[model samples]
Target: MILLFGLFFILLIIGTSIANSMFISSIIYMIYYGLPLEMIPQRMAAGVDSFTLLAVIFFVLAGALMNRGGITTRIFTLAEKCVGHYTGGLAHANVLASIIFAGMSGSAIADTGGLGAIELKAMKDGGYDEDFSLAITGASSLIGPVIPPSVPLVLFGVTASQSVGDLFNAGIIPGILLGIIMMVVNYFICRKRNYGVSPKASLKEVLKCFIWAFWAIFLVVIIRGGIAFGVFTPTEAAVIAVAYAIILGLIYKAVKIKELPSVIKETLGTSVSVLYILSAATLFSWILTYEQIPQTIAGYLIGLTDNALLLLLIIMLILLFVGLFMDITPAIVILTPILLPAVSAVGIDLIWFGVIMILCLLVGLITPPVGMVLFVLSGISDVPIAKISRAIAPYLVASIGVILLIIFYVYLMTLNPSLPKLY
Candidate 1:
């Protein structure tokens, strides 16, 4: 097991995709264990044959559809109305719009790419620092997971066998906390730099734009609420979201029939990559379990520290380091199962762990070398990573603060004293 683990890391470091890396690693392990090659295809196929995982594809499609629908403008317009009077108004607007849309998209890259252009251009026109604008936008996009319909949390629940609805609800307070942290920090920066502040609009003006976006955001509320209340399953909610987004798009003329091909094509492209990685990771995890790898590692860690919080903190640091080079989706898919039982063995709540896992993965979207959100924002704002990295210092601090909160406090808020009997 140790030898196989070492080889996996080597393949990963050599710039292999997680799927290819996992496939190779699995093959190596089978040979090492004297297993037949025939099981490889079978295990990989079975790993991906999950009904819950269908939510992954649906969420991706919903995000693409929402992006194409006229909802993007309504969201931005609503954000502009609410925050355009603040110093660094456009920057705030971008972040605000992302929080709203994150509930819909569940992807930081989608938030940055879809909503970033307007914010970047507005901040530049308003004379804010380019690096500052991009860095803030990039960091703010992390709110996606914490907000709602979080892809990472969905993937985490499926991988770890936690309740998806509980994980979604558990994210609400922490997500709001993250957004508030960003807003306060951003406010300080704006005042310090003397950034532009738009003139205050009338109540009527604010309400007008919000009314325009009311239907758009209402869709998010209905989908999330319906799922939580058991009015619909996650799969059913996704179908509704797609239909709603399409209707709004056609009504507002934001999307047309000719554009359906492009939207579906993009959705299919991304879904395939994500699902394939999931399948590969599943087979890889099966091998790890077969060798009792997590059990062995967990035993050593328990010996090192019986204190649950300490173990969780240590694991978090390792995850932070992992985030530097790996993307969130694959990282969570790979690590959640390995670490979950260890944490739960110490009485950690699965829902809270899901939050921590998602938060840790969210950081990967902004960290170096593989910071997907950072790169997207930089391209839109035309800022260098070095400068963006420099500007992101405060947000890095904020994200860490959110992580620690979940580690120590969110468990109390999200978990019941006794889990309800499943039988």
Candidate 2:
């Protein structure tokens, strides 16, 4: 196991693709142990053969659907309506808009692209700096995976055999907390720069936008509320969300028949990337299991530390650093299996730990080296990565503050404790 892990890192350092890195590392272990190659296909298939994992494709498509269905614009309108009166009104609206968005789609990249494209442009048009627009939009996108129906959380739940509904419920409070902190930080900064909404919309106009878009808003409630009351599983909720978005899109005349092909193509491409990594990672984990590597490491770690909190924190730090180098979805798929048993050994709550892990890694995806969100903002704003990363400083501080709250404050971290727990 140590030899395999060492080789994986070496492959990574040399710029190998993570999928191929894991694949080669597993092959080294199999060869070392004189195992048959047949286990590879079998284990890989087992990993990919998950019903819960199918949620990844569904939610990814559902998020893209809502965006095309004119729901993105409606969400922006609603956020703008409610927060456009603040000192840093547009910035505040960006934060709030992301919170609303995180509910509809549990993907960080999707939210970043969907909401950031719209809000960053609006911010620039409203007298905000391009870099500043880039920064806030990127940071706001982090909330998506921490909120309900988060794709990473769903993946974690499925991979770890934790409760998906409980995981969804557990995410709500922390998600809102993440939103609030960003809004507060944005408010103070925007006030300092004196960048509020330019020519704020009339209440009538904002209300009109909201009224015209009311059904789009309802999808969040219907999906979340239905899931909470046990009316549908998360997978079923995904189907409902797609149907809802399509029906509403048609009713609003926002989605035309012509858009279907492009939408399907995009969704299929995205889903394939995710599913490919999943299948490959599963094969890798099967190798680990066959070798009893995870169990052996779990035992070794337990022997070293009994403090669940310390162990969990250390794991988070590792995730934070790893996230700096990789994208979130692949990281979650690859690492969750390896880490779950070890954390469980220390008695850390799986669901809570999962949220913490996702948050840390998601932030990493926005950090330097390979910060995916940073790159997204760079592409959108045409700001250099170095410059956009500078803009990330304050929000990064605020994110760390949120991370600390989740780590130390038990009641607040868990949020009402009565919210069905996920671990």
Candidate 3:
């Protein structure tokens, strides 16, 4: 296992793609152990042969379609009108727009790439500092995977054998709470910096913006409502989302039929990238299981601390450290199998644990060194990575606060029988 991880890191440092790194390391481990090479392709095939993964394919397509369909602009316009009068109004709207956009697009990259451009432009035009605008945009994009229809949550669910609907449900409160806390933190920061507010929209204007955005907003409600009411599975929800996005595009005349080929091509590229990582990680995880590495680690951790709260805190810290170095997708694939048993031993609910794991990992999207969202923002804004990292520090602290709150809430729910389960 040590050799396997060492080889993986060496490959990563040399600029190999994550999927390729994992595949190379797995092959090395198999040869070293004298295992048959044939097992590799078999496990890789088994990795992606999932009914639930169909959701990932369609969701990726739906996000791509919506990006090209002009849904992002409507959502942003509505967010700005709804909250543009608040302290740090654009910052607040950045976060608000993320929450709304998150419902439509379950991907943080989608949120950062699609909406980051518009939000940063709005902030710059409004006389905001470039670093500050970059920070807020990157930070708020984390909300994309925390809300329902989240790609990470779906992956986590399928990996852990938890219900995807339950994971989505569990995320609602934490996602909203995190957004609100960030908004409050932005308020103070903006007030201290004297960031000016936008002109308040009149009641009629607010309604007008809302009316224009109603179709986009309705997509969120329909997806979550359908899942919660048992009207559709998460997979079904993704298909519906694609259909709805197409309908929206046609109705608004924003998405022409001619553009779909390119949209589909883009989705295929993104989906293939994700599926490849998942496939490689699946084989890597099988190697770990075959070595009993997960059991060994779980036993050691369980023996290290009997206090569930302390154990959870320790696990979260480890995940945060891992997130600093890894992308969330492969991290979810590799870590879920290793950590789920340890968490189960500590008496944490799998659904709650999944949410917490995702929240911690999403924070990494804005973190330094390998922060995917940071890179995305830097590319879009032409800001130095260091400047964006420095700007995002306070927002990082606020996100930590939200993570702590979730940990406490999970503890409370575990203790109280009368507490309602989001599942």
Model 3 weakest 10-residue run by lDDT: 414-423
lDDT (C-alpha) at residue 192 in model 1: 93
Q: What is the lDDT of candidate 3?
A: 0.90
* C-alpha RMSD in Å of predicted model 1 compared with the true structure: 2.7
Query: What digit string (tens of lDDT, one per residue) describes model 1 on residues 123-191?
Result: 778788888888888888888777778878788888888888888888877787888888888989999
**TM-score winner between candidates 1 and 2:** 1
lDDT, candidates in the order shown: 0.80, 0.81, 0.90
TM-score of 2: 0.92
**What's the lDDT for residue 275 in model 1?**
82
lDDT of 2 by residue, 324-415 (tens): 88777678777787787887665566777777888888888678998988888888767899998998889888887787677765333333
lDDT of 2 at 174: 86
**Higher-scoring candidate on lDDT, 1 or 3:** 3
List the candidate 2 regions with Cα displacement exceeding 4 Å.
198-206, 410-423
| Models sorted by TM-score, best on top | 3, 1, 2
Q: Pick the candidate with the highest lDDT.
A: 3
> Which regions of candidate 1 deviate over 4 angstroms?
410-423
Ranking by lDDT: 3, 2, 1
Off by over 4 Å in 3: none
lDDT score for residue 115 of model 2: 82
Query: What alpha-carbon RMSD in Å does predicted model 3 have with respect to the real structure?
Result: 1.2
Clashing pairs in 1: none
Cα lDDT tens digits for candidate 3, 266-367: 999989999999999999999999999999999999999967778789888998999998999999999999999898886788999999999998888888
